[model samples]
Structure formats: C-alpha cells, structure tokens
Target: RPLLKTALLGREIVYIASIDSTNNETKKLAAAGCVEGTILLTEEQHGGRGRLSRGWFSPFGKGIWLSVVLRPRFLPQEAPKCTLMTAVAVVKAIRKVTGIPCGIKWPNDILYQGKKLVGILTEMNAEMDAINHVVIGIGINVNIASEELPPDLAALATSLQIETGQPVSRRELLTVVLYELEQAYALVNTQGFDPILEQWRQLSVTLGQKVDVIGLNNRFSGVAVDIDRDGALLVDTPAGQERVIAGDVSIRPA
Candidate 1:
C-alpha cells in the first residue's frame, strides 16, 4: 500500500504468494461485495489463462499477475470499454518506466517488435440493466529471464528484461500501472470513453494492417480500420465491414 498510493484503484489488496489466477480470485471477492477498488495480486499463477483459455506463462517473481475489481454504474454493454481503458493505462505506465514505445493490438494485447509483452482479460458479473461488479485481469512480463520461459512461449513472448537488457523493478512498474489506471478510470467516469478511444487508436499497431480474425465459429480476413466505443474491432472485409468483439487476431502480409 505504501508503494501504491493511488486514490481510486488498489486501495484494498489481496496479496497471495501463489494462486490459480488473479482474475478468478477477484471474481470471488467481487461476488462477496468487496470494495470497488480492491485488487488481487499474486506472485505466481500456476493455472493462469489468457483470452482463449491458453495457459499464460507466469513464473514466480517474473511478471505482474493481478486483477482489479470495479463496481462501475455503466450498463452491461459498456463493460468492454474497461479493457480498452486498462490497455492505455498500462502502455503509458510501461513507457514512463522503461522508455520503450509499445503498441496495443486490437482489444488489449501489448506488443513490442511483433511479440507479446502483455495481455488483458476482463470478466464481468452484471445484469441486463446494471453491473454488479467487474474483474479485469492484467498479466505483464516484467523481469522474466528468456530461458526460464517455455520454448514455445519464448519465441512469441518477451519481457522488460529482454527488451531493455537489464532487470526491471516489478514493484515500481506495478505502482505506476495502478496510478495510471486510477487516473483513466476517473476520466471515464467524469467524461466518457471518447478520449480513451482516441488514445487507443493512436497507440494501436493493428489499425490499417491486413489481419485475420478467427472467432469461435467464423473466420474472416480484413483490413483493421477502427474500433467502436466498446472497443470492438471494425474491419473492412471483402464482403463488408464486420464488427468483431472477441477473436484471435493475427496480422498478415499487407
């Protein structure tokens, strides 16, 4: 709590040495009517998972594995914007700490040099008209040594140590991330998602690129053009423009 002096987020924390997943933990807390800004932070996640339930490479003391609980008054349909809000916050925090300019993939994947640096997953417990609470999970590869990562993951993932050739202080990075998120959340509550959406578009690497989006039941190819207010991708396909909410997106040859 001393390291993180944020006003809105991280006021209440549940720090665990090891856990299945921070998101799952936060969900339980959120269900029990925990404080709105409570955070679930784990040093290690033995069963961490990402957007498509793919196992996340979260070795102990190498990355940031955490989830934030929010009780926003927004409708259920507006929950997805929180993911967008988090992506911009983390990107800004990373740049401030490491001086590395990273870009955000569609929805909320942070990438550097075409390899994944961070991933965000958001879950909500809401009714049709209102939201009960939300748990947004964020995983960042901070000081993970390259060799410690699995062979399959090392090829497609990176860390702050590998990007900068030196170790990073996870504490400092996590503090900055929470501060940024608090500020962004306050902005969204005061104004709207317009400003954040504009910032997301500016920091987006996927926009204006030819990409393939594979959903649960459909696959399509298109040029990534824009994102909606709710952070859905707006793609111009051969048939027509399609609104993609959640999918496995891969940028292809333009």
Candidate 2:
C-alpha cells in the first residue's frame, strides 16, 4: 500500500490473491476505463505468461507477480521504449535494496551471474497512432530456494534469497521497484530516450558480443552492435548485413 501510494499517488488500486495473469487483468481493467497508475497484484498466477507466449512459472507466495497499468500519451510506436525504461528501474531497485549486481538482458530479463532472476512482459492497447494503455508485468523470484525451482530452470534461475544467502522481504523489494519505476516513467516522458538508453547500456550484459537471434520467422547469428532509438537491438549479421531489431538472442563471448 505504501509502495503504490508513493508510486501512483491518488489512483485507483486493485489487489488479487490469485489470477490467471496480472497483465491480462490489468488490460481488462484498462478497457473498462481504469485510470492510469492502477496496479494489479497476485500471489499466484495460474496462467502466467512471458514474452513470446512462453509459460512463466509462478508458485503461490513464492515470488512477486504484479502488473502496472499506464495511460501514457505517447505514440504507439514509442511503447517499446517504456519496457527498456522499466528494466532500468528494476535493475536500479535490485541494486539499491539487495546490494547485488544485476545486469539486464535485452528486452526485459534481469540476470545475476548467468542466471535469470526476473522477467518483464509489456502489453499495450492502441488506437490509430496513439496508445490507449500499457500493462507492464514484472515477475521476480524473491525467496524461492534453489531446490524449489523447476527442473528445467534449476540450473538457469536464481532468487533473491538464493543469491544473497538470506531471505529478503518481498514487500521491501517491491516498494523499491515501484519507486524507481515512477522515477523512470517520468524521466522517459520529460527527458526523452537518451538518458534511459545510456543507463540501459551501462546495465546491459548483451552488448558488443556475438549473438544468435531466434525470432518468430527466422534465426540468425550476429554481433550485437547497439540499441536503436526505438529500443530494438541493432545487430551485424552475416553476408555483410545490418539489422535494427532482433529478439530472443543468445549472446556469446567475444
């Protein structure tokens, strides 16, 4: 409550103990004229989802699963920038609260060492040339022990308690994340993308490396060049090619 009040002052609030997906619920509320700054939270998500429709693992009371609804006046094309901004905010919050060094993978995965600790999915409703609303879903593994992770994710995932050698407060971490989110959101609207992009670059772990991009249509190998103004990744491909956007990339050491 304190976090939402600080991050979204004077806005309608919604809370749920269990939901199919926080992002989906946020979208429904937005379509029904829910105001900006409204938030939806759940302790367990039966149908939790990740980017590209992948299933997200969310156990009951084991992680932070929440979504924030926004009614920004930005153009539809600029929505991607907001996801990157959110990543920056999350990394900042993680560092501030836990004193752990977290790096952002392209798009919205937070990594520690080489394991994923959090994932963010952003969904938007748009009209012609303008955005109606955006629902940013954030999932963080807070107190889950290493033994509790799914077999597939056991070797590839870590939690706050696992990384920090002690349990951490989910409420405290969520508060820091929401506070940083408000700051980043305001900066993106007023200052532009450069500032956020710079912070993203500093926290990014995928830049200037060999990468294998696995997209919906095709897969290709490339060297990550930079992030464009619209936040799509720039890559240098084979056959002397250059591309502005690549998704699901596997970054390799140079």
Candidate 3:
C-alpha cells in the first residue's frame, strides 16, 4: 500500500478475504521461491494458530491476521531473536496508535495491563546452520468487543478498541506495524541483536518477576533475571540458574 513506508516488508502483499492460515500460505509461497518481504493478509483465519500449538481466536473483520515472509541471513540458532524483535515492534506500534502502554511477555505474547492484546508466531525453514526462510505470523485483536470473546478468553484477552474505548483502523495499524518491523529487521541485519534485546528488556513485563515456566515435561519456578544472547530466558531457580529456550511462562505476583 502507498501508506507503507518500508523498503522491503509489505512491498508485495497478498490480501485475501479468508484463509485457513496466513502462516501456512506464506510457507507455501516461501517454498515456491517467493521473494523475501512478501506478505499475506487476510480478514479472517479459520484455523489460526499460536505458539506451543495453541489455537488463536480469530473472528471475521475483528482482528489483524497476517504473516510475513522473510529471508534473513541468520542461522537457525538466532531465529528466536526475530520473535523478540517483532514483540518490540508491535509494542511500539500499539503505543503509537492507541497511546496505551503495552508490554511483552517472554517469547511472543503482547500484554496490555496484564491481558493479552497480540500474539506472534514465528516459523522458519533452515538447513543445519543456515535459515532458508522465516514466516512471522502476527495477530492483533483490534476491534473485537469484550462480550464478543468467549467466556474462557474474556478474562485473559483484550483489544485496542476495548482498551481505547473506540475502534482502531486496522489499515493504519498494519501500515505502522510494517514500518516498525522493517526498522527492527534492519537493526537486526546491520547492528545485531543487542539493540533489539535492549529495547525488548525495556518493554518487558516478565523480567525481574517471580514466574513459573511449563515446558513439555519440565516445570520450574524462579526469578527471571535476563534473556541470554540466544534469546533463552535466564531464571534463577532454587537449585541453580537455568536457561529456558521454549516454555509457557506465567508471571507470579510480586
């Protein structure tokens, strides 16, 4: 779109009325040699997904359901940094658009006043050491009302409209998101992950908190100290310090 000020991201967008999943479509495109920066935007996603294989709640014309195809020249080990960078970008975009404070929970969830406002899922294809492509899926609850959400999610999920007491233009938000993402991606490509990690720490709600992390077969409670260079969470447990690469983190009260 003309409103987008990014150099690469969102330059070639595939807009659809409906789809099973934007991530899935973007992967297909990436496999067929689609150029980097190609994006897929849909009004509705029938089978949207989130991190840890959880189902994302996506209703028609109520949210931003989109995925971007990227071919960054980073190794697979550095992929998690992309996810963290995206969280920072989304937080900045939300604050700029709605003037509401938002923070990122570790890994990928964006929180506003302790409730989830956005979810990001990043998937990548790689060789042993080199990444072939990455699809960053972003879903933001933009205009959904409180009552419209299921009772199970009513307590944990929120939207921009709900927080601001007015509808937000998805078009404007999407353009800003692309611009922010492009800036962050450029930072990662040029300067490295340190700047992105620093910004993420500034907007984090999980750091310096007692928390519980639930992995596939392991769980632990600790004080989240910092995120390592690889983007794994470093927690000080009763036994010792541990680095968590993948898990569901729940922040405990101070």
Backbone clash total for model 1 is 0
The digit string of per-residue lDDT tens for model 1 on 11-119 reads 7888999999898888999998899999988889989988778888888988999999999888898888989999999999999999989989877689998889999
Candidate 1: which stretches are off by over 4 Å? 247-254
Clashing residue pair totals per candidate (backbone < 3 A): 0, 0, 0
lDDT, candidate 2, 1-254, per-residue tens: 74443646226667799999999988999999987888787899999998767889899898989898888888888888878988999999999989989998887789998799999988889999989999999999998998899999998889999999999888888888888988888888799879999999999988877877775566778887788888888888777655544245444444
> What is candidate 2's TM-score against the reference?
0.93
Q: Looking at model 1, which ten-residue stretch has the lowest summed lDDT?
A: 245-254
Model 1 clash pairs are: none
TM-score of each: 0.96, 0.93, 0.97
Window of ten residues with lowest summed lDDT in model 3: 245-254
* TM-score ranking of the models: 3, 1, 2
Which sections of candidate 2 miss by over 4 Å? Answer: 3-10, 244-254
- Give the per-residue lDDT digits (tens) of candidate 3, residues 34-136: 9899999998998899876778999999999999999989888888888999999999999999998999998889998889999999999998889999999
